[model samples]
Target: MHHALAFLALSQLKGFGPARLNLLLQQCEPDGDDFYADCLRYLPQIPGLNAQQVQLCCQRIHNPFHGEWKERDQLLHWLAYDQHQVLTLGHADYPELLQQIADPPLMLYLAGNAELLHQPQLAIVGSRKPTIEGFNDARRFAGALSELGWCITSGLAEGIDAAAHQGCLQANGKTLAVLGTGIDRVYPRSNQPLYEQIYYQGLLISEFPLGTAPRGHNFPKRNRIVAGLSVGVLVVEAALKSGSLISARLACESGREVFAIPGSIHQAQYKGCHQLIKQGAKLTETIQDIHEELAHWLQLPESYSSSSFGLTTDSSHFSSNGLLSAKDSLPAVGAFSTAKNQQAVASNQSLELFTGHSHSADPSSSNMASTPDAYNPNLTAVAIKQKAPSVPKFDNPQQEQLWQAIAQGAGNLDALVMATGFNTGEISQNLLMLELSGRVVQEAGIYRVNLSV
Candidate 1:
């Protein structure tokens, strides 16, 4: 919370950017595996920290953020209100994918289902201006995927993205809406209904401070969240340089999968999808294509072997782009995926960390390595199908702690550990065993007892 307030104060300043703030953080924030906030005695020198900018903003001349308790307290008040909360990367509550982003939001303001941020998410994105076919394509894809229990994620824009959310909801699936504006302000005005529904059904998340307006620049930053939260981002319809294309780029940069639906050869709308396919984005014509991709990805043998990709077994290294690398050479992080696309009036922006389920997937698919029931297909979303009452089974001390924590209303892993007085390692093992038994379900980052338990 302290760091969140400090970040907000810096964000409110006019000249600060990710680069400059990163400099400040490296010098002043927590070090190594420890990530916590402490009071600053003086403003540390950020290579490009602007003195004039601080002065203009009424910050202390030498100690720009010194003793800014009143302002911090005000931010605390906002956090305490309904539809207001904040989370940061590296913390237990923060989304794991956001940590993989090139430039992530330091402090995000979340308006709903703060828990969903920790769940698994998929990003569905496309051009704001799309053809009628694009809209149908987006909705159908989202609905099919949601029916399989995937959380639909998207920027709450007017066209393809909006349709994606509607489809997810119709499938009784969960969705997340990420925004360029503050959590309280719905941009474009036309998406207000979707926005409200997401607030009630899934979640609405943002990096912009409370009451921040939707300016022209925030969308680019918003795109990062759209791409960052998902296992992958799917482009429904886009121009070569459309905002949705930016999301695909961001997804690539973050090492997430990029999928594109092919459009008609004669249509201008298909150009971007075709371009992406040619450039190596996965060609996604059906949900099964995605499922197969995930299944293949999960089936990778732990032992790295280039022969799996048709490369010579004697190969010592891979192409500069890693296309021919040994299977084990692929970074461990690229294994998971996000199934993007859900058509609804709303798109969920919530991101959260999952300690237990992060390594698992729905059992119905062979792609999931950990176990069949290790995770909920809609783990990252809040599917409103009456939130089926779950009963968790506990065969170990760790599993027992997980249930104890939930029974006490501790909604996150950290809280569960604190409440159970157990180390994360032991607790996680217990949770994993419980999940594999299908007695428990992991959502976002929290664990709950499934009805079978």
Candidate 2:
């Protein structure tokens, strides 16, 4: 059996967590192959194992196929899919930054691009109901950073998380959605379209085992992976008790940089960002603030430099062009592939990541939708794409004026106010009407025409 499969079996033993599994692997030193028999032989000699513990270990090692992993077959079935993969702790392809965490997961289930796990990631997290301004900020920052070769990572929740992912997609950039549920499941059901988009265009990650559901406790656990996978975390908009705050704290604990966008003192949504700023997170207003801070890390040794993140050195990171290639830093293509598997595609294009599944048949074709109803969770993927959406006719000249302003790229609410010579209330009312009719969408207080019509 493959070592990963053997580790999966060993991982199923009761009482065998990541720490215990690490200890067992260290003692057995199973590099010679037949890890199960080797672990069985070493179980008796390893210290810290009582007689009963040793006996149980031996039983598990002797008959790993009969171990307690109820989902072993399910895992095998998932792996049979081209893009579905499991990276064990000792797997050569496991993310290096994730290994630095205090309690790393034994394995990570990956969908979409497994190679993206090696890319430089910046986590954007915030409240599920952030103000429109906050939503735009997350989207703008995500898009900007993606252009700089950063893979935007998020929990895939609503509000700020959705904006960050959408912005990255819009920019034709790389993104990773770390799920709180199993890799197979999409929670909130409302994000089904977003989930499908990432499944085809970006990466979906989870440390949870197969068949896991979205439980309250699972989100905090998921936040750690979001932080661990990133070089930094940015809290776009969050409440004091927000899960985004938890991700920021975890990033700090993991030695990753944390950035927070400051908001008004009176606003309830900005309180957590203020708290994070007070806790030494950088006060960020623009992407330049983030670039300056992370540039310091580029000065570190090769082991800690941006090259280690599988990101090439651009003009932003280096004074000269092409100082380093992303391919130079990452493992060769097909490192984790089997004989039947085709070679993984390179991440040379702005949007293309590794191609592990049949979805790679044409990676350049984008699936972005331009309307609010495009993400109607009730609609299937084919329905969303093939359905002839009705365009709402506008009888109000003011609403048409506002829509035209947004379509022309003057998306900021204040900008729209200036361009249309309308008061704040008038612009707000017309924009709301446009949004309601699916003619426009707003984020971070910026309104844009929705092309679905």
Candidate 3:
């Protein structure tokens, strides 16, 4: 049988989960055409498969197209439709990032642009019933980031999720919805229109069977996929027990960046965000705040680099390893290269603002928070000097160290990694923050001290 059919049959096995299925799949040759036959032949030898499970697999292999999998006809029908596909775990198109997760789905049912799975994605997740302000914040962030070439990924729930998808749509940018229900189903019937739009303009993805209805337990699995597929996750507004926090936790576990927008302490809905901020998720206020952290990790699209908002710096100074070298000096991107020149630029030229969230909390609110040794997301520049030894006039010793490193010609990720003994993620986050704040400049991939700063 075909690999997808084999995976579908194996998935229907009563007790087999992703872990055991993955273990079994590992033993089968990925390139083989008759994967079901291989699974049946190797069933007894596969560890953790009890006799009953082995017999069931053998029976299914003997009758690959037997009356098992009531949803098989639906799956086949969906697969035959335009732009519909099923990506098995071992499929080349299966997302590498999702595969890295602890328990990846054995298969993903996808609609719309399957190729989009490979693009840079940022997940925006939050409460199902959000305040108007929170809803607007979701839209605003999603729109801004979408214009910058990010594919916004979110669970297709109400409130924040809907707003995010709408925002991306408004920007005429790509957005993806990971469904808690099946790929063929749209929950909350209210979003049926939005679902149609995404099906044509973006992508719809799910790991559940074709007819799986929305269930409370199914969402956490959906949440994991949303978190797994993105390079970072932004929590707009969530209560203490919100599933958005779950996504943020999973993102943290996956080592992806987590950003939380802070709201008033009195607002119960924002407590989750505050809790996340306290737990080392970056305190995000502006799009620049997100950009400050994620810019280094993402390859900005050509439109972003050439857009009015981009800095046009020389690319020739880039080293063979894709990092900038310190040997050559290049002109800064646009007039913002210098602090004085930045003042001359029109105020309208400034980055867009999402005003629903504020930064009123004292930086010291993180007193109970544990600092991650590499990058402390909640640690502000002001608190850095207080937390660490004073480095002359520099307010942030980490930034100061990074600046000195760049000044000394350690210009790339690898160079900084070797020079400061910090990991790539730490260096990337810090360097991007410095660049966004105008204290440092990057030409091509190389980093340098902004003499004007």
The TM-scores of all predictions, comma-separated, are 0.60, 0.67, 0.67
Question: What is the C-alpha local distance difference test score of candidate 2?
Answer: 0.69
Candidate 2 lDDT at 148 equals 56
Residue-level lDDT of model 3, residues 268-370, one tens digit each, is 8899999999999999765656776676556643333332332223455333532222233212335334542332221112222122111211222323233
Worst 10 residues of 3 by lDDT: 352-361
Whole-model lDDT, model 3: 0.70
Off by over 4 Å in 1: 29-42, 52-77, 295-453
Q: Ten residues in a row with the worst lDDT in model 2?
A: 349-358
Q: Judging by lDDT, tell me the better candidate of 2 and 3.
A: 3
Q: What local distance difference test score does each model get?
A: 0.62, 0.69, 0.70
Off by over 4 Å in 3: 46-53, 66-69, 301-453
Q: For model 3, which pairs clash?
A: 324-446
> Residue 215 CA error for candidate 2 (Å)?
0.8
Overlapping backbone residue pairs in candidate 2 total 3
Ranking by TM-score: 3, 2, 1
RMSD of each: 17.1, 12.3, 18.7
User: Evaluated with lDDT, which candidate comes out highest?
Assistant: 3
What value of lDDT does candidate 1 attain over all alpha carbons? 0.62
